[model samples]
Target chain A: MAQLLPSVWRHIPERYSLLGSHCENCGKDYFPQRPICPTCRRKGKIVQKLMPREGKIFSHTLVHAAPAGFELEAPYHLAIVELKNGVHLLSQIVDSDSEAIQINSPVKMVFRKISEDGKQGAIAYGYKFKVVRNAAAASKPGKPVGKQSTSSKK
Target chain B: MNRSGIVGYGTSVPRMRIKVGEIAKVWGKDGERVSSGLGIIEKSVPALDEDSATLAVEAARVAVEAGKINPQKIGAVFVGSESKPYAVKPTATVVAQAVGASVHMTAADLEFACKAGTAAIQACMGMVASGMIEYGLAIGSDTAQGKPGDALEYSAGGGAAAYVIGKPAESIAVIEDTYSFTTDTPDFWRRQHEEFPEHGGRFTAEPAYFKHVVSATRGLLEKTGMKIGDFDFVVFHQPNGKFPGRAAKILGVPDEKIKQGLITPILGNTYSASSMVGLASVLDVAKAGERILMTSYGSGAGSDSFWFTVTDKIEEEGRRQPESVFEMLKDKVNVDYATYAKHRRKIKSL
Candidate 1:
């Protein structure tokens, strides 16, 4: 019989965000948060910044050569997305085709497991974006899988 | 000038190589398929589990094999790549751990189209020059895949190179001055999360390759007040063999100076590490008194040029690795076009 490992599931803040620091002096943004602005070579005066999850696919590719342990998931799409706040990012595209992914396909932020640490067995979790559906999909009669409530907006 | 030359070097070419004839067969063409106007005969594909980060680790492993210091003393690990395995995930941590670097160190990834490798070196050199650490490792590796038959595919290959930055006494070469120029232009760019990059070829050729590289190299020479003739060698980013040749002529650098880094004729363009890896090759046979000038260009219109002076330390670090830069390139592994498509996962269901 397959055994389930003990798991510690926790919500990573309702206002979860990928915080960055935008130099008030030069307007360049640093991701994963930086104390000092790199461009201005300034010390400690940059403003706290938060970029939204919603945006569009600026470009994308189907990863036919899947990473190790992801062979079955070959041809999965990876995208470069631009968020509404003008932040550009790279992410995986869920439930879509590589060809159909265009320059401006709308997307929304979500959280998913990226990879397991090769050693120590720690699982890493991070925020990513997926395609945003139309009003029709939102108003559908049945609840869809993988849908999370948007009440805890960042 | 402080010596920041390559102390160690390594590369990763896929076990399998796919040929043009095989690609022609899959498309059901009798012969001579244009392959989308890119003159790529084949490409190296990673196994299902391999990625840029893993390849970077392999390259670094080879580079450090003959190096004098213990791996545990490495103060920083920097990876320069455009096709990183994860968007938000920093591959440097994994690479650092894999290479047995000190836990307390700076680790990060850099991306500037293909110039990511040299940028990582510049950052490492800054730390080394500051005497913050005894040694720093910089790697440029990529598994950049071009859309089927696109212009970029033929020239894009999977590869990596590593350099250990340390004190001049133990260093093979010391880094001199570095100069860079930047402009906001979209000659060639991959948007935030894009897979395939977009380019205006003529525009990319002129501005991204010609204009910026010329300006930056001239700017560096002007700042240092050194003539092109003073350098024993020159290495430029290899978007294609032709681009560097053209740029070399335009900049008054000699043909032999440009010839030192033509691995692209066999391996294709390796984004960020293209020029630095070539410099590593030049360092393999360079004498203690030689001088090298390196120039790198990235998309979005930016260029970095730096000076290097070879030292006697190169003689002390003889071959002690499984795959020295020369040995790695000499081995063979080939795959057909169908396998290339299968490896790249290019087939689409109708």
Candidate 2:
């Protein structure tokens, strides 16, 4: 609990807003906002960038074994998502069934509670991905499509 | 008023829902009776990870995207909620940072029971209308609390709504007029450190919800010289499904005019977000040149009323992604009583 405050504060920018660094020279984006671009070293033009929340699953794995502090959410799906800007990051997939998540599945970012420090400690929040099963269906005008079934197609 | 209006608006309801029957089953009460009495079918329940702050951020992000404004230009952020996660910290700062608003922006948290969200809106209108800010974001969100097996549990819900207020030229709907009515009516309250609020039962309606809402609406109409029939739509704060419908009849507004904004029957009462979300739902499908009347009530208690005229810009801005309130309501996942209890943190572990 003592170290929780600093760690939480340090990750605020990246966790909350997906703040990252962009290397103008190579046009590459990096999450966690690196201070210096590896390609150009001191000559690199690095600036703060906000990655688009929309993305697709690059790779994913199901974690049946629970990690400490994540016991209640055990058997959850963890995925490596590649943002529209081509930056990849690891995050937990939520608000959908495991069967609905596939390689290259379209996804969107959502802020959610990641974990709690203790029974009476501070709660940590960060980004998670939810599968957008039918992008086309969601865009259509008129009434909203009720209940997103795993079988629905865009 | 200095020609300020709503540049953009967005709403969010938690995906998880618990039907009236589920709660009824656990308490061994007649589901149909409770459902009929409250006029609510289901209520959104936040996931273990979701709270007022998160809901506010989601709604604010959608509003920002719709407005197509630079986050750096926003001058203020106000979040109104009865369920702010922290007692000491301001939820507005977290919302401002999460939405990438400028660091120099003013931020604060507000509480006025259910009407707190509209109070934030009134504040933003003042700042924007005075030319003191380029744009201001006002948000109302809540994970409303109700005691275990209490009547409040059936209607208390979780959700949020956000609005971006700016110059009239950039607005989707121009603010025609606004009014407020306040008093020391204690129809409902939650004491310090109390887990849930206590209400005066039927007293919550007569002298509190209905009284404030009716007075505010009448005041706005009388001040603006607009009759009930002049408005295209009407929205009232929905503590329960029945109150808004009743208020509409009392104000001489037809049922058809209020139907579009009557979302409480399905989404339950989102406390601070109730009326705001209903207004957003109405705006989603409203056409250019139409007028909207809105009134919000907060137990403790008071009401705020506003009149808006939709512009052509609403057609374009209302179609943006993240979907509308209707879409969010349709796309829901139902959970049983056990899951609801777990999600709501109602089940305690020693």
Candidate 3:
């Protein structure tokens, strides 16, 4: 817990939220944020952009084998999501049927416990995707608040 | 002092539920009798990765969005829960950062058993009313735990509710007044380093829940000179489906008056989130001028009661977006006892 605190502290902003960096010059977005834009280099004006929480599934895989600290959540689905901003990022798909998961399926982000150190350790939290249900009634994937707000009320 | 009011509210219920029958079957008890006795058909269960902090953050995000206010402007954040993720660290800080609250703000974890969430609200009301802050975010969230085979297991559940409080003019519901009744009657308690809480059984009634609820409620009604008939809706802390009804009867309130907010039968007791969630459900369908009375009970034990009047802003702001409590309640999947155990950590790997 002690050794992991610093990294956890540093990543709290991005981990606890769906924050990405947007390049004013290139109009491109990057998840986990980027200090510099590769497309426009020094001329790029980098700003923290609140990324959309809804997206379409690009691809997915099932994790049958458990990793350290994730044994209990074995056989969870992981997918590369094409966010509304067109930034494809990898995240786990939870709270939905495995058979229901498919490519191009609409997904939305939710706050969930990602990991914990142990009995008395700090619980690490992050955003995870879930296959959106009630698609026909779905208004739209998302609406960015003031341009940078995360996800739609949908 | 500036008047404080509820600008916006949000709820978070996990996707999983374990029916009373599923849990009762594991203990060889009659499922029908157990559910009928407790008036709970099923209880919400959190995912393996979900806890008080995560669920609280979910609710808070919706509230922040619904309030249409910048998170940076929220001057205080208080999370009330019995099942905080970290024992040493503050869950309020996690929610504060998660909601993008300003660095120049106050945040803390509050505990008062089930009413802790309402207590968080009262604290914010104080700070806001005193002109100390423009707005405050109060949350009640819990991934409540109960011992296997214990009576509480059938009703203890996971859920969260968040309320963004600001000035009356900016509120969707104006808070009229609040009252509380407290005493050192240990109806329920979890010892240090204990996994589950212990209770005084029927003692939780009469001397604990009832005493506090009735007293606090009548106290507030007297203070405001409002009659039971004046309230269009009433919400009382429900440890089980039966208790709220019984409390209403004792208060001379009609059974139907609290029917809308009596959600414990479907969602189980969300602990600190209990009454706050109930109030949110009522506000979902309440009209612009409707009056509401809410009382919350936490087993340490005490009751915090309040009066609120819905405003035209409730209709203007709308209720369905970000999902209402009724909507979230409908989006659920029932898990078996084994899966429930695994999720609740009743079946730990070590």
Chain B TM-scores per candidate, in order, are 0.91, 0.98, 0.98
Question: How are the candidates ranked when ordered by DockQ, highest leading?
Answer: 2, 3, 1
Clashing pairs in 2: none
Once superposed on the true structure, which residue ranges of model 2 sit more than 4 Å away at CA? A40-43, A141-154, B317-322
Each candidate's TM vs. the true structure?
0.67, 0.95, 0.94
Error of 3 at B100 (Å): 1.0
Give DockQ for candidates 1 onward, in order.
Answer: 0.01, 0.24, 0.23
Native contacts retained by candidate 1: 0.00
For residues B288-317, what per-residue lDDT tens digits would candidate 3 score against the true structure?
A: 778889999998888999999888888763
Model 2 residue B227 distance off true place after TM-score fit, in angstroms: 0.5
Better of 2 and 3 by DockQ: 2
Give the least accurate 10-residue stretch of model 1 chain B, judged by summed lDDT: B319-328
Q: Who wins the DockQ comparison?
A: 2
| Chain B structural similarity as TM-score, candidate 3 | 0.98
Please write out the lDDT profile of model 2 over residues B1-350, one tens digit for every residue.
57788998888878899999899989999999999999999999998889999999989988888888888899999999999888878889888988888898899999999989999999999999898999999999999999988999999999999999998898989987899999999989999988899999989888988889999999998998878878878889998889988998899887777777878889989999999998988877777788889999999989999999988887783444357677767778899999889888898871
Candidate 3's C-alpha runs over 4 A off are: A135-154, B318-321, B348-350
How well does candidate 1 reproduce the true complex, by DockQ? 0.01
